[model samples]
Target chain A: MLNYLARRLVLALITCAAISVLTFVIIRLPPGDFVDAYIANLASNGSMVSAEQAVAMRHEYGLDRPVVVQYALWMGRVVRGDFGVSMMWRRPVTEVIGDRLWLTMAISVSALFLTWTIALPIGIYSAVRQYSIGDYIATLLGFMGLAIPNFLLALILMYAGFRYLGLSVGGLFSSDYAQEAWSLAKFWDLMKHIPLPACVLALAGTAQLIRIMRANLLDELRKPYVVSARAKGLSELHVVLKYPVRAALNPFASSIAYLFPYLVSGSIIVSLVLGLPTVGPLLLQALVAQDMFLAGTIVLLLGIMTVIGTLISDLLLMWIEPRIRLRGRA
Target chain B: MVEQVMTNPGAIESGGHMLSVRDLAVEFGQDRGSVRALDGISLDLRAGRVLGVVGESGCGKSVTARAILGILDRPGRLVGGRVLLDPGTSAEQNLAALDPNGAALRAVRGGRIGLIFQEPMTALSVHYTVGNQIIEAIRAHKTLSKAAARAATVELLREVGIPRPELRIDAYPFQLSGGLRQRVGIAMALACAPDILIADEPTTALDVTTQAQILALLRRLQRDKGIALMLITHDMGVIAQMADDVAVMYLGRIVEFAPVRRLFAAPRHPYTRALLRSVPDIRAVPRARLATIGGTVPHPGARPTGCAFHPRCQEMIAGRCETTAPSPVPAGLEGASCFHAESVVQEAVV
Candidate 1:
């Protein structure tokens, strides 16, 4: 078991190395550097600077160095709590994304739990009661959830918020976040604003989970073991819940191996609409502004989160399914 | 003295029979598109002896068991039939027509009729421990407290002859070996003191030695509990060892049904004859080349008209064999369907 974990960790490191290299190369691919962004912003203010001054700024920021040197330097510092400065936010990348990371994790994971809690019972019920009116209705609902894309659902809900509830759509944290420090009152206030966007984000993720879980349960219901369970004179509820449902959960739970990492990607669309300061929007801004240092760090961070999430899930799978652990040890 | 009447079907049981399936036909989907998994099948399983239904793949042996258990899903319809089971004391009920999760059938199934599946572990839940699952099953049928359910489960596991049943009650299905898992399956099935146990290829997935052990265990249990055994398998050897009577099914129809000795020693139907000939008996030392039944079990959509087995029947009797399906002809024990039974017997004995 220890050897297996060691092997997995080595593979994880290789994966992280690949991701870091890709992030470094991809972030630098665009034409302009930080100088161009500064020049363009200052030009709009009618301020002109000499080519020498530009050269001086480039050298100061270490942008004058070769791409590989810059990548190595930034990665080295990043490993020690220093993600380069964000050109747009004019702050450290970690400081900018730190609190937002918590918010995103809360929204996404909670939505995931809600999705499973709802989907499991409904999926099993519909599958066992297949061809009945309830089954038809549940299937119809699943179809509707699938058809109406999550982002579109978010837009519709936001539109409703504007029209009916008169709720503010200014992406969770108010405009004055640059001035205020983190506080309990501010956190609750942030959550209050987080609801619509979080829900919108959850809609797609929850829908995906519901559909997958339903499929899993339906497949399980068809297994020979389920038939035997029913023959054992078990109640319909017990049979579905106990025998079929567990076998069905095998595939679904294994996918949980990637769920948290996918959660980072899942938050991208909703985060864009809400403008809640998360890595998604931060990564986007860094790309557009040609902030290579900041972009590389954020991408690396996200990659790390994804890798870590998958690893933890893999370890959890052993506890969740004793079969895997026993097989491994044996 | 009891075997006198040649024409009349001798009921397998001296006491009241547990399950009597009469003319059961399972057609999946529409008429033209429908699959006849079991066509006009009739049989009886008494309170004790194991009545084995042996056949090749897709011969409707498993379908017959599923129909009794009320587990057949959509696309597999029980078109016509009556699965009459005497619920110990209640009125005889036809399990065929009961809804998949209907109240009355639920009372009969898992309540009166227990089933052991081909793959035992897959049928047991992975999320639940084997002990808790059986306890829940016991609680499902009767009013048993948690402690009582646990006690019943331990005792039931012991009854199935699991080693250190009390210690192993907490073990999950995947933790146990294949043979032990099968024992758990049996224990779960017998929790309700069911009168009939339908074991569909119970030993098909086990090792040969484990298979023998399970067969022995089942026989002993049947004797002790007086529970009927409707064993379904494709292995003719298993049928020969365990079955009191044997039914040979071909393309969803019971082509031959008789006492095991008679069916094996002097087979009647062509399909049955081919099946017996194919099996290499160690008893026959200088064995003739084992007969091979040509062609696979045809899909439900393409089953030939009239006789479903005629396309492959070696004893094709002019137009009658291919054009008009032969029905069961009453012989020594009960049912055996074939046009040239007398001639086949004559050839076999000579």
Candidate 2:
């Protein structure tokens, strides 16, 4: 097991390195650099800058160097925990991302929790009582959840909250708590605003998970082991939960690998629509403004999360299923 | 029904019948219509005796086992039946009449009767150690402490011929070979010390050598425990070796039920004779074509109007066999549901 863990860790490091290079190249792929966008912003604001000034700014930002040198230089600083500065925000990338990253994770984790708690029982029900009225209803609702876009759902929920409950459910905090320091009230206010965006983010994932879980469980319920378990005199509830449900949970556990990346990237449009202070919207803004450090850092973090998520899922699968654990030894 | 009761009068009179399935019928609902999977299947499993149910594939052998246990899969319902389970001490209870999901049936299942499934590879849960599964079965019926149950599980493993029971108790089902896994399955079925054991094609998935070994183990265990064993298989050799009585089923119905020796020596039904003839014999002429029963068992949905075996029977009576179903006729301790059981025997002699 230790050997397996060490091997996976090494692979994760190589994956992160690859992701860093990819993120840097993609960020630089646009026609212009941060200097160009900066100059354009200044010109649009009715200010003029000479070509020399623009060149000096490029040199100052070290953007005039070849892409390889820029990547190597950025990587060197990144290894030391310095993510350079966001050209747009005029702040260190870490500082710019610090609280936003936490908030993003907070929302994502809550959304994931919601997804599992709702999907698991519903999925099990849909499978065990397949073709029942409740199964039909769950299937219909799951399809609707999958079909509706996240941003559109966010808008609809926000409007419904405002119109029906007379509550503004757009952002992470109400006006009174937006600028307040951490306190019970601010936390409570944040909690109240989180559900709308979290639900919107979880809708698609929940729907997909329910379908996966139902299909997996349906396959398992007919397996001989399930019948054997039933013949063992286990209660119907015990038989279903212990045999088929546990087997069905394999896909659910493996799905955690994608959950990390999905939460980081999948919440982008919903975050933008809901105006949630998350890394997704920040990454989008950084990308649009040619803020390489900020965008690259966010993307690299997402890549790292994906690798770590995969490792966690692998470990979870091994723990749940002994067959995988034996294979891991090989 | 009177003839049915008369056919197994010796077993009922001897008070040795552990499970008596009476005219049990099961139907599977499909898109086209409901097909009768088990039509009036009747048999008696006597204590300290092995009753082998032999049939071709899809002939409802497994369905009979599942129906007796009241664990038939969905869309398959017990349309009519009575599974009278007499566990010696308690009053006889009709299992088929009980609610399938109720507590009464739950207690009887795995408590008064145990089932050994075919395909050891798929019968045991991969997530659990064999020991854990056996312990669960043991505790399901008995109020034993966890350690006690574990000890009992190891004992069962040892009894079923699993070597190094202490070490093997922790191994998952997937880690074991097919033979060892089936041993675990047998141990699990015997854990509750049920009076009746229903082994549905228990050795079908095993290799030839493993099949022999498993059958031997099952026979020894059944004898030692004096459990009424209903061994379902398609192998006539297995029936001859292990069974006290044999049931020959064709398309959901038992065409012949008799003592093993009599059935093999003077098989009354033409279907049973054909089945015995189809068994390859080593004494036959070298390089000769092997005997085979013509035609396959028809789909249950398209069953013939008369005896289910008539279409495939060489002794099928012309007009009578095609139009009218033949009910079972009692003859001492044996019976055959064929229109010309005597004629078939006389023709064989001629």
Predicted complexes: DockQ each: 0.55, 0.87
* Chain B TM-scores of the candidates: 0.89, 0.91
The true-versus-predicted C-alpha distance at residue B171 of model 2, in Å, is 1.0
- In terms of docking quality, model 2 is high
CA lDDT, every prediction?
0.77, 0.87
Over 4 Å off, model 2: A44-46, B1-15, B30-32, B87-90, B329-333, B342-350
TM-score of every model versus the real structure: 0.84, 0.95
Best by DockQ: 2
Best by lDDT: 2
Q: Tens digits of per-residue lDDT for model 1 on A216-244? A: 77777787667777776667787777667
User: In candidate 2, how many Å is residue B190 off?
Assistant: 0.6
lDDT comparing candidate 2 with the true structure: 0.87
